[model samples]
Target: MDHLYAMSLDLNALLRDWPFEPGMLKVRKVTGVDGREKLQMRIDLGVLQMELTGRPDGMRPHGCESLLSYHQNRAALAKAAGNEYELSAEECSELQQEGIQYYHRYVSLFQLNDYAGVIRDTQRNLDLFSFVDEHSQREEFVWNFQQFRPYVLMMNTRAKASLLLNDGKFAEAMREIESGRDAIVEFFQKSNFPELVSKSSEIAFLDEWLEEVSEKRPRSKLEIMQREMESAIAKELYERAAELRDAIKMLKASK
Candidate 1:
């Protein structure tokens, strides 16, 4: 009789090598046995392996790339037939679950400093939220998913601004942050949750980050003179203000 051996499914060696940290997102990219790149996140329990593209788990639902894509095609077909299509509560729940998979992938991508991937996934979730909000049969299902809009918006904004920062465009990054802040505020107001704006941690974080970026941004000579002129005028120093104003005019003319 031939001796038989079994392949072990245990992750003991893998988890032992990469111990989980308490407050850090530990992620890595590796080539799979099939020679395809994959993302692996280290968690407290063990490890999570994800596809670098497409669905995180690399599963296709309804023969479509994603649940969102599948539903979008269905909606398009219904529209062409002059029929209205709305997502049922169960379908909405399914979408919510699918969104979670994308969320995990984006968060892991962010940790890997892949800002573009982060933006792509966040934007996808935002589109998913809009679709469900527009077509969900129940308001409660819409609310459940839409409630996370602010957080996703913040992540998207952060990624855009980070890309600008990477290119050493501090002023542009600041503007991007401002735009993101406005978007969050608008979302709250439109959702009839204006009261939450003041208490929004996302908005507060962006505001603080914007201030820091502004303080560090390099200023042109003309901009500096303009700021000085404004300060002098506010302090009732007409002579200083007039001098700065004339200097600023000369600088602008030279430019």
Candidate 2:
């Protein structure tokens, strides 16, 4: 199993200077060996879909030597979510539930061989990254207690731009759409887990959703920030309102 890690290292070493954009592969993940050893696997191309003989080790294979290697003659595994990192149990449950819905909505996307649909739906799932442990939201890490964001936004923006380009926004949304492209690439690069390449967007939609959730009903901590923003707005604090808006995700469904 450990040899898998060496193989992956070799692959990376080979491709490190390929000059191809890193996230171009779209898939990122570590796989355990033959279901018996959880020490290694390969990455690239797409998400982990192998039915290994064993369950996930419940921990990411770490270290250059401890990680597994890529399967022989097999393509590098891609990540289903923009992220390919681990998480806390509670957070994992929430993400899994959301992931199912994402997969279902576009279930036919893949069935019909709609690669675009696959991209859109997959990106949306990653963008809506959620953390049940609310406090963890303050920290922006891939394994931040089941949280999934940043990268998702990048994928979502690209998906949106692709769809929008096909729609009627070609002329009007050019600036934002282009900005999204750069953002998607930028943010993805900064992401961990599946190791999203840098990507960007016009608006951090998920961040807004969280803000709306905090404001619509006001959780204990949210209530205070909500008040501050309201008061600031009343005092002509346009900047403050904008800041607050950017700071939170507007959880309309939470209502």
Candidate 3:
């Protein structure tokens, strides 16, 4: 009798030697075999294709909707059934795992200069926090996700500021930075993690960025004018806002 020996392959190890550099990431748009459009992040040793909507892989853990949707709907049903809505720790952990997958994709997207994709993914994670906070109300779980809030906000604001800066919207970029800083402070305050609000390196980075941006601009008339217009609008002074808007248009035309 003749016996054949089989060789086993360690694919993960083999992938480490992929042609791409370890830190390099690429986002490619491709049509899947099923004729669906997919956005895929190609990293050093692997690829992650995310769904444009719904869950990343369209995974609904526990045969329920996304943790967010599930809890919202279940909360409604529970109210109707005279029951209370609660998410078990297992479900919370599962949702956290799902968020981790998106986190990987967003980080890769950021490295690849896909800032818009980063914003999109980061917003979805924020929505996850909202859902968990609304339904769970478990201090530990809520705090766990809250602790992650600032980092996501930081990345989101980075993407926003980058886009605005690319568009020559200096004032808008500054506003984004300020908004992100305020959001981080608010999150920490609400969660009773007040000490961390002032201590976070992310907040410090935003402050540094804001200062750098402030010094970089010599107050281009259009930028200054536009900021005034935005302030007017925020204050419900539409007439003044319109006047400033027209003035800005005229200024741009003069230039």
Identify the runs in model 3 with alpha carbons over 4 angstroms from their true place: 1-30, 37-45, 60-65, 80-83, 221-255
Candidate closest to the true structure, highest TM-score: 1
Residue-level lDDT of model 2, residues 1-255, one tens digit each, is: 899877865654534533344433222223445443222212353223322121132322232211222111011232433433334456445445545545443433333344476575665455434322322333443354233444445444445544554564553335444565455555445545334331222245534433443344324556666777888899999998878765544633354
Model 1 sits at a Cα RMSD from the real structure of: 2.8
What would the C-alpha RMSD of candidate 2 be, to one decimal place?
Answer: 19.2
**Better-scoring candidate (lDDT), 1 or 2:** 1
Q: Per-prediction TM-score, please?
A: 0.89, 0.28, 0.69
Ranking by TM-score: 1, 3, 2
**TM-score between model 2 and native:** 0.28
Cα lDDT of all candidates, in order? Answer: 0.92, 0.43, 0.81
Candidate 1 per-residue C-alpha lDDT over 35-60 given as tens digits, one digit per residue, 9 for 90 to 100: 99999999999999999889999999
